[model samples]
Target: MDRMMMSDLLKTIFSVLLVLVVIIVSRNFIKILKMAVDGLISTEAILSILGLKIVLASAAFIVPAVFVSVLMVLGRMYRDQEMSALSSAGAGVGRLYIAVFKTIIPVVFAAAWMALYVSPWAASKVERIIFEEKQNIGVRAIAEGKFSEYNKGNLIFYVEKITTDNVMHDVFVQDKRENKVGIVTAEKAEVRTINNDLYIVFINGERVQGNAGEVDFVLETFAEYAMRLDSSTEIQENPITGIDTTKLLQTQDLKELSELHHRLSVPFSIIVLAIMAVPLAQVSPRSGVYGNLAAAFLIYFSFANFEKVSGSWMVNGEIPVWLGFWGVYFLAVLFIVILLVRLYGLAWVILQLKGKLV
Candidate 1:
């Protein structure tokens, strides 16, 4: 009975996990593609980012997927009267838990590894890839006969024609700075990297700098001039998700604390939710196969929202940092006790507890 039950649960978990991942990745794919088209990220990096995204998405949704899978698998058993058959054969709720946990124990460890380690690594890689791509914006943004804007619209670059050897003819650049604007036109130009900084090197160009329509405008002509585009010294502020778990452990930042708590919650949630699913999956055999799914979904979403709200509460100091999301987990466990009591009766629960204690 244990082997058979575990086999069904594993199959359901895989199917549910696959569906969740596809739905999530499809939604994110559009956003990633838009970033690539806007030149915020390079086209070549898209596939790499997408692969990493799948990993991140999988790790995240595995929690919900496992919960839903357990509910579905056991709910079906109830609906088909298999649970009744087992009960009549001297099996009980404790036996069911044993079978279910045979599958869940391994899953909890895997989810812990992914949440604590792999997810952060993937996030860091994605952030670094995007950062590196942005540094090459000077070369990536070039297109003949089109105007491109960069640096939050502080600079505009136009190339009338581009050649095979990466030379531009009739290039124009408009740079906007505080209280002044500079316009430059060149006969020939090319993007070049020097000293780890990107520059637009122009040959035989003239630059005009001053306020608009001002008589004090300054004009300078040069045989060759260079304008710095991007500096390597600019630091990229990585989000908390990208930080290594080991580094997160060394800090007491509320935001970072909340992130650490969030990562830990995944494995903890799997165990708690799996425990809840056993009793929650109980339904009248006549109630239909999907009867409990609606309620289970509502409970899952409520738990998810509570996680977010509690994380915010911790960050805002409304909740003790020590409590963190564990308070929410505690409430979930309490709800599970309530469910088990309702299903098996309070007297039976107490009797079982007493027996276990003995």
Candidate 2:
């Protein structure tokens, strides 16, 4: 009977965690879809990124949300006197932790897998997808009135306004494609596709062309100007966020070290948070289960946010790599100690403290 009851409890907690993950993933999907609709991203890119986004986002929240699920389940049980009944029936509150940790171990490993491997892989895919789209689709990938790099800094474009009919006004473009640089300023422009190719058509523009190394330079006024969108433009650097764990481990650069530690911290944190939640999840019989939910979220978010801050500090060389993640772990351990003391008794805690001191 105890085994069955504990099984059901674990199942309920997992079910709740699943729902929360789905809700989080769905909200992110809607946000990304809106970007697609607004032409900020291509339809093909959106479709390709959707699954990866869900996986990455879901992995991010799964471990943290586990605490909320456990809290709700345990809080409900305690609130309804189910825990009290089990206590009377020869089960200590400590017994509940046995079932809890059993359910969490597998989840902790899974979260670790995602944090260290799957999420980064997905991020790399998103970066690759966006890069490919920009290469194939050209300036159409950029919204009007924004500064955008054309071919990885070989060119840059800015527009003051874009009309409903897809016409642009007050255009500024820099051409660094060849040894001779050109700067073009136009009153109006149109991005057009001709013969299965993309071109920017500038009207009433002044073109300034020169090589600084030579004395020869030319400035010309044009009724119309056009430049082809080239595909050879490469992005400058791939970010540490998308790099593989093995590669990150091999590198000792500040940013990569920070990223590697951040990834490692995610899985380790599941154990920390799960421990904190076990005792904190206890609720009074007459009090609502959700009474502790807000506080739990607050604590969890504070911890998670601080992790990002520490990582930033690590990247900036404000702190050592060991300090970056270990400080957060210390805080978690401190929190768990406090929670355990509260769950047991102040008297027992003081006695234990004195014993340690002695």
Candidate 3:
């Protein structure tokens, strides 16, 4: 690659990385700030979590952001006639691709590593830390007169009042276990931990239980009762994002297969965006560099959201695994090739020659 092209690519990549860090950090700071405001995390913990949040957030947006940044940077060069200088010197889009790809290769590698490994590790670590913190928090500040959900809404708790001494009054809990539903009401309750297990001890309470789909319900009254909470509510587990790729391949479960494909696609998307950005970066002579911003964003988000929807369908067996996540990516690649052939000078000539030959 020419020095000028390489230098340009490096400069643009550096600029893109800076913009990504700023935009992603600012956006996710709002979310982490809310956690601190709600007293779920301290200011110190928020600071710690900020780095992890950035990793997770960056993994999600990096592909699309790279596309837009590349478009703007390369588009600006073309707009300012810098690219024309190179073109007149006998350089083509292919040489431009060479220089850009040199820069993109390392970025794609880092992105793949983050998407496949670091992002999940960061997310999982944060989840475990938060889980432990909340567990230690231990119903200490149960909201009065408001229903609190636990274990993905499988368990619910409500307290009419909480005393200064940590005693709870008028406790109501609903437990939804597979095939069974239980509702318990008590005059008072308190949290107890035994050997790392949490329990809610109720006094003067009645319990009602029923099958999920049956009319028969059972009720019993007790002077005192204790119920253990086995739910840890881990945020990410067993999913392909958390599971090692090798381990994911050992299973044939549709959900897991779908997840594996989805996670695999995450890294693959970096390459896709890099390829797509080249031809898509070309702004018409009549339009400014920002003219294609809307189209670029629309194309990217549509691909991502559609892949998510298609992944869900694959998990549910509505679509076959072979044609799931890869299908969306294949379509993206096909679209990019079409655009390149139509817009990139030599590619267009080659396509026309092939058509004439046929």
The per-model lDDT (C-alpha) reads 0.90, 0.80, 0.77
**Residue 103 alpha-carbon offset, candidate 1, angstroms:** 0.6
Candidate 3: residue 305 lDDT (0-100) = 89
Q: List the residue pairs that clash in candidate 3.
A: none
Tens digit of lDDT per residue, candidate 2, span 121-157? 9988888876656555546655676888767788888
Best TM-score goes to which candidate?
1
Clashes of each: 0, 0, 0
Model 3 has a clash total of 0
* Ranked candidates (TM-score, high to low): 1, 2, 3
Q: What does each candidate score in C-alpha RMSD? A: 5.4, 9.6, 10.2
Candidate 3 or 2, higher TM-score: 2
**Candidate 1 accuracy as lDDT:** 0.90
Per-model TM-score, in order, reads: 0.79, 0.69, 0.66
What's the lDDT for residue 310 in model 1?
A: 89
Highest lDDT among the candidates is held by which one? Answer: 1
Estimate, for each residue in 31-99, the C-alpha lDDT of model 3 and write its tens digit: 888877776765557777888877777776677667776787778777777777778999887787787
